[model samples]
Target: MSATPDATSAAPDGGFTTVIGPRRSLLAIDLAELWRYRDLVLLLTRRDIVTVYAQTVLGPLWVVLQPLITTFTFALVFGKAAGLAPPGMPGPLFYMSGLVPWFFFSSQVTKTSRTLTGGAHVMTKVYFPRLVMPISTTLSNGFTFLVQLAALAVMVAGYVLAGGLAWSPGPQLLGLPLLVLLMGALGLGTGILISAATTKYRDLSFLVGFGVQLLMYASPVILPLSRLQKFPTLLRVFELNPMTAVIEAFRAMLFGGAVPWGGLTYSAAVTAVMLLVGVMTFNKVERSFADIV
Candidate 1:
């Protein structure tokens, strides 16, 4: 008689044996799987974009209004009252430039940080890669951010036409892509970290909202790094925020000014480290998510 086949043996239909082993520390993110779910990502992203503007009469106009209003307020408070120099450019242009990226960064963080909870039903019921949730959130906000950025460009043109602005191209312009990457990396990394933590701790949601407001004040959205001259120590601390480099780099690129190479490099380094840590932690916790979350 033929020897009995073992449990590990392959089935006649071509199915392979399954084995349970220790979970790997780093999940080998399957790009192919993500590609297969690209439609889902796009669908979810579209949902977010639509829901964000659904009830508002102005709809997507809110994107343009948000930064426009904030920039105007900052221009009045910081530029007019504080007598800030406006980053060697016109006051409105300077304030709006920083507001654009600052809003993008903050919005990305807030939106993505809640991805897991916001889509908990989908997460618990679905088998797709969990990373897709936060990523889709980022992409959704990114689309709106681009729209707002176009409005910023039109405003810049208006400033130029009125002789209130002067601009030139600089090498820093080439660094805008890198700046955007760092911003996304920083937001994604922190968002995942917070989202995972918040799954177990409910209070984190409130903290995330409060923290974002404080973070905006901490960043140089309204005030330029140059204005921090009197507080050299504070300036140094701000430089360490990672976003400091991103906002400053954005200003430099748009205004044709000197690049903040030191700060930018620091941001890149921090982003790399944080992303690695956040991904690892996220993956490790992902398995038990359905159970706990």
Candidate 2:
């Protein structure tokens, strides 16, 4: 007697079996699925960019103006009043160099951390990878980073032509792209972890702003690593912060300084671990984010 075919059996039209069940593997990233949705990612990213400056008079110019204004303020407050500028480095250059990456990191972390909570309405209406929200936010911020970086390059060129600053391209510059990638990964990792946690505890969203501000001071955005050397313990703390290495390495690439390879290697290791943990945590919590968020 012929037995009835099971519902889970392969389709007659093709040799494909469709299984409808919960994901068996807990930590899988599903890169294939994300790739299938690339067009959506781009669309979301473009939307974020446009919506940010949609009605503003200055529009995209705000990207350049924001960093430019911050650089000047830091130069005045830190360089002129506090006397915190790095020796032999132009105060604006010094601050801009550090601020460029710091802003990118902080903005990504802040925006991406709110993805699930902010996009809740859309998430409820449709079905897609929740991870896409944070990722698209990161990409949108990356475009802003590029705009700011270009502004920085123009400023650097002006300084070079002014006969005060010495600009030399070095081998360390080759690491710039890698450094940006590491910074993004670090931000994404931390942001996703916080976002997952915030699904249950809403207070985390409130603290994120104050925490980011505190974290900036903890890193070497306004101050240089050299100044922190007198306080060995504090210097060690800064070294432990992954951003210290990234900022220092970025400055070294632009100007001339010793590349802290050991610190950078440590930061890279930490970033990798954070990313893994963040992804796993995000995946686990995302299953229930719609209900909680």
Candidate 3:
């Protein structure tokens, strides 16, 4: 008489398995699970960076070139034509300073907003934390941001050496890392919030691009806050935009401008609330994303 085969060992797949289920807690974020899946996060991030420029002639150079071209275009339209550059700061330098942080924030927001729909295939097949998708996209784009920032630093250094610009970083520059973190938090929070919504309402995905474009104008991107002083109401409204403080802090850090402590504090508070709301919404929606996506 032959022995019966073990039921559990019948299948050939042998690796460890993770059984995912519904989260019990309403505000559960599962940071521990995310940490446990750090390898997967790194893998996904590498894939995002590689696939973004795969088979392209320029490859990663586009990371630096895209911002360079944008800064030049802004210098022409807003600087030469509209004369919107902040006094004493060169147009290209001023624009590049703002564009570096804005590019990172905008790219992360756009990519994270599509995480659920974009990764539906993997989500259906695997049992990893869904939060990894957006987190990895944010991490991958962060690498691109560093590349662009390095190029900006080089240009800024050249301008200083040529006497076209001056350098006077203060104690506020030490807070640059915190400022970057705030920028990422704002983008991730907003993106994940939108991502959860878009899983049900597909049209919301189409609006992300337009919304981000409008947001850029609402912030102090092309024109400095100083230029809008005549319009106190408009400036106050702009201050309400979280990005406005981040951009202002970026400029202040790099160019010896006045740091807006009040605005930054407001932005930080708003960012914390947004992130909490995003995590809750994402947790509630992630359970059914595979079915609808």
Candidate 4:
């Protein structure tokens, strides 16, 4: 981030110059500095969303198709053969709820993980806030998530017309924005943490692809949180996953149920800690990224 001169520190020529340099404070972020670079953030975010499918045949259609395909696959494997979905709830609706949020989170971690290593050329040439890289990626993913979420909303509406099945909008829907913030925060925190590490440990860049897949099961994506009850030990482990509550709350908001206040409270705390630690570590490493990456 760049440092601003005080109001009285103008040069004798009466010109104010902002100095671009390394971040000095380990735990404190310069929100004003970050705000000044908001244009760059918006640019990078646009690039992130556009470049992903720029040359692909389907382009943005894949955004809708990917979730639908995965939802049905899970519906077949987990809901039908395994008999996992709660009775009377449509399998597509059940899994789509989880996939919408989970996809946002996983994409954040995957793309932001390469902020330094994959973007070393630009990083070396530029003098913007290092934090800008990850924030743009998170924002771009959030935009894509909104597209997917609209599709999910249509599915929920369809299911409601067919049987209602407690799938109607209510005041609970208001909490959705909070859940989106939590989801983005978790992804941003974890993403930057990995992005910083990947600067020195190049292997993590490759491992992140496999790691997110494994982490999906560790959360309640394919399997509902309730089914884990038989394995009390495993259930305890899954309970600690912050996304469980976020995803569950997301479903409850659409399907009508009580909020998972306990899990969401725990999730907010964990996300706060992870984001703080992630930002501090990222800031501490900013000066060395060019050389190390």
- Score each candidate by Cα lDDT: 0.79, 0.86, 0.86, 0.85
Residue pairs of candidate 2 with colliding backbone atoms: none
Error at 212, model 4, angstroms: 1.4
lDDT of 3: 0.86
Q: Please write out the lDDT profile of model 1 over residues 95-209, one tens digit for every residue.
A: 7887888778788777777867777887788677788888888898788878978998999889788888775767667877767778888888888888878888989999988
Cα shift from native, residue 189, model 1 (Å): 0.8
- All candidates: TM-score: 0.90, 0.93, 0.91, 0.92
Q: Considering TM-score, where higher is better, how would the candidates rank from best to worst?
A: 2, 4, 3, 1
Which candidate's TM-score is highest?
Answer: 2
Pick out the ten consecutive residues of candidate 1 with the lowest summed lDDT.
Answer: 1-10
Runs of candidate 1 exceeding 4 Å displacement: 1-14, 17-22, 85-87
Tens-place lDDT per residue, model 3, 184-288, is 988999899999999999999989988897889888888888889899999988988999989999999977778889999999998898898888888888887
What does candidate 2 score on TM?
0.93
- Clashing pairs for model 3 are none
In lDDT terms, how accurate is model 4?
0.85
